[model samples]
Target: MKPLTVIGFLGSTLDASKFGPSRWSKWRPSVALTMHEDLRVDRFVMLHGTPHARLAEYIAEDIASISPETTVDRRVLDLVDPWDFEEVYGKLLDFARAYPFDPDAEDYLIHITTGTHVAQICLFLLTEAHYLPGRLLQTQPAKRGEDGGAPGRWTSIDLDLSRYDSIATRFAAASAESTSFLKSGIDTKNAPFNRLIDEIEQVAVRSRAPVLLIGPTGAGKSQLARRIYELKKLKHQVQGPFVEVNCATLKGDGAMSALFGHKKGAFTGAAADRPGLLRTADTGMLFLDEIGELGLDEQAMILRAIEDKRFLPVGADKEVSSDFQLIAGTNRDLGRAVAEGRFRDDLYARLNLWTFALPGLAERREDIEPNLDYELDRFAEREGTRVTFNKEARERYLAFATSLDAIWAGNFRDLAASVTRMATFSPKGRIDSDCVASEIARLTRLWASDTKGDDDGLDPLLGDVALAALDPFDRVQLAHVVATCRRSRSLSEAGRALFAASRARRTSSNDADRLRKYLTRFGLEWGQVSG
Candidate 1:
């Protein structure tokens, strides 16, 4: 048996207040502590107030999601109550007795960092008793003054020299690589909606609750919902097709029957048995749009469906079962409605599991140019137009986009309409500020005429400039340009970086396709950008 590595987690009233759950954004304090596979490890966490056993399961789930390859025995040990050190000693005795360490396996890497007083005492006990095979402290606040002033200085301490160093180094490298990989992926896509994507992920993973995405019409609420569904699917947390219903259009008896299904002859109008939206959405996501408009009675029925995971079909004698994750979207403030007795509080409570407030187009001023540019590309591709942005026009578009205040209050629909107008009115295949600004004025009039309000429109477009140095790909592509112009390495030097390493001996046409993809990411093309 290898040394039974014991990891100590701090679970105390004080520590609980400082870390865990709410500190979700904090990158793990010491990736160094958790990185090695060579050492056998176990984890113990302490929490103040909350049930430790219950919290342990949440932590275990999170850790498994993030690092699927690792295995560890996890527990929450409480010893701070009654202010007795013996409570701490008693718990450790049981743990140490069960899985005695075997140093021969190069085993027993104890990594514990939790927020609890009992955990701290346990750390001290293991060190004093010489039973701590390996240990890791996840976080340490700077020592504060008597009056809570600065304790001063930051430091790192490690034990177990070679073993600890080896483990930490390997872990750091892998962590850095993963960080770099995600960064590269995000950068490559220029994902302007990254914030929305991130919010959905955190909300889904952290809480087993319904997420209500509220935004103005055409603000891409449905699109965002589908994107979230896809991401959840990728994570294997969701398996059912995304079932969507626009509640504003669902009317009277039809709405109930559509959502709850009906048995033949149960209702006067019913001719045959029908399965409702509730069942159709079994084991998947049910996206309800315009939920604020659902009638009071229908709201009660839907609420029951969500809370009980079962619902009665229209005209059906018995209830049917279906499990579905609910994601509701609305433009109205349901909270205010609840207070005014306009919305059902009971149903609201169930849907309030998690709520995400989406920023309107006007609020996300920074996103205007990118979204426009993306739309422009889509239009250009659809038209098969050889469109490249001109400097003055692009800059002017960007300026207008960033300058808007109440951008139509219509959200994404307004933006799409603006894009269509700009594309339709462009004189030169490329668009300029005139295109963006003119549409804004036009949209202002159209929206204002419709609502008697000067609701706003999209900002100007941002122009793209070819890098003076060309991208890495371009530089390499025109290597001959480099060879002839810069008088640098000949075609040979360029070929090596541009070619596959496997074909060191044969250079011509060697893995050029693979090289181009990597080069494109570098922002380079053959002769134009390079040399």
Candidate 2:
């Protein structure tokens, strides 16, 4: 709700000729100016009407992500029109006086966008007379061409802001930090999350820190870690597969065996010698999911493995060392758990050295739309449905989502489930309020009935929603196998149930390939989400 950050992208849209008719249309000139990447305007105050709303909407929608802080405002100060001279002059003076810039000079960024020559002249005059705080308007080209029978044909020029006025004094920091990992690094150095990403991005490139991504499950902590991995991949020392380890499955002695390779007869279950996860992840990133669940004994062993880069197998006498980057994940708070004698204090400290905490969906409500848009695109591509939610639907959905309590224990997972359900059931092309409401109501009734039903009848299963699409040409079917996996939430168990039912449907190597592809897109392994 802060004031818009003004950035001047000022230029001219009129390219009328001296003698005959206008050499080219001003309509197209204005049109092109609207699409300029750096032109940060929120409310496009139209100078003229013919090149109307559709132009404003496109520019606002397109650059909305880039200029997160600017408000693109437009106003047509008609000088030659029938209105009296003083009336026009008074309005201009008032507008220049009331322009929503911070009282202190340093807070605003003036980006003057291209329009009429008169408009640029007016802005220059106003700024020069101290009516506006910043510099003069910058006039940019309306058209690009090789020659109009001259050495070079140029339509516009970069007029300095000093043409109108100039000022000096700068002590304060920015409204937000300019440092970012993405194209607009504004958010990367703002507040809480800023320090985390900045340090991570910097140290990740320079030093080697066994990154431990700790956050509530489904907070996109892993995704952030992956981003860091990608960023590091840009550096010289990093390369190879980002191997993953689920310590939840590596229980007791089994955990030891999985982490450190075992010789044949290392244990009763060790029918064959095998390399541990650490080795399999050699010279790469080894992601350990649910690190909090690791037992005390296992924690001590992992500390050893980390310190020495070596570990003794469950039954093997010799030691094997691994050279791999370790990245740990967990939903539980190891700090609190450590104080209470659950997670090991030492392990927690080592992992905490460089950490990133992803704010949950309900925590950072501003990000809901962006995340939803991303998820919608992802699900649409996967489902093969050209589904799009209209503004009304998105607004309502976001409002409802942002209003939720912190108990959205599942976070993005829950939102995704809701979206996938809506897309699957909502009539062919669009999603609306009816769709959102109906899904919620149907689930409510189902839950009510399930809880209240008598033992006399079979307990009804929950509303298990799954989205699947098919590519008939390849004879490949993308099925979430919703029916068989009705009772499961885990991806692996669901996949197991799916495979059990899949055999009854059809047996094909192609189906397995399709399934693998689906798993990759979902970021799930056969063991994670199946049954």
State each model's CA lDDT, in order: 0.56, 0.54
Candidate 2 lDDT tens digits, 319-397 = 8887767778888878889989989988888888877666665455555665565566556445433245655776667
Candidate 1 differs from the real structure by a C-alpha RMSD in angstroms, to one decimal, of: 25.6
What ranges in model 1 sit over 4 Å off?
1-197, 380-388, 425-429, 432-434, 451-531
- CA lDDT, candidate 1, residue 154: 21
Give the per-residue lDDT of model 1 (tens digit) for 365-415.
666665665565455435433233456666765665655323345776777
Against the true structure, candidate 2 reaches a TM-score of 0.48
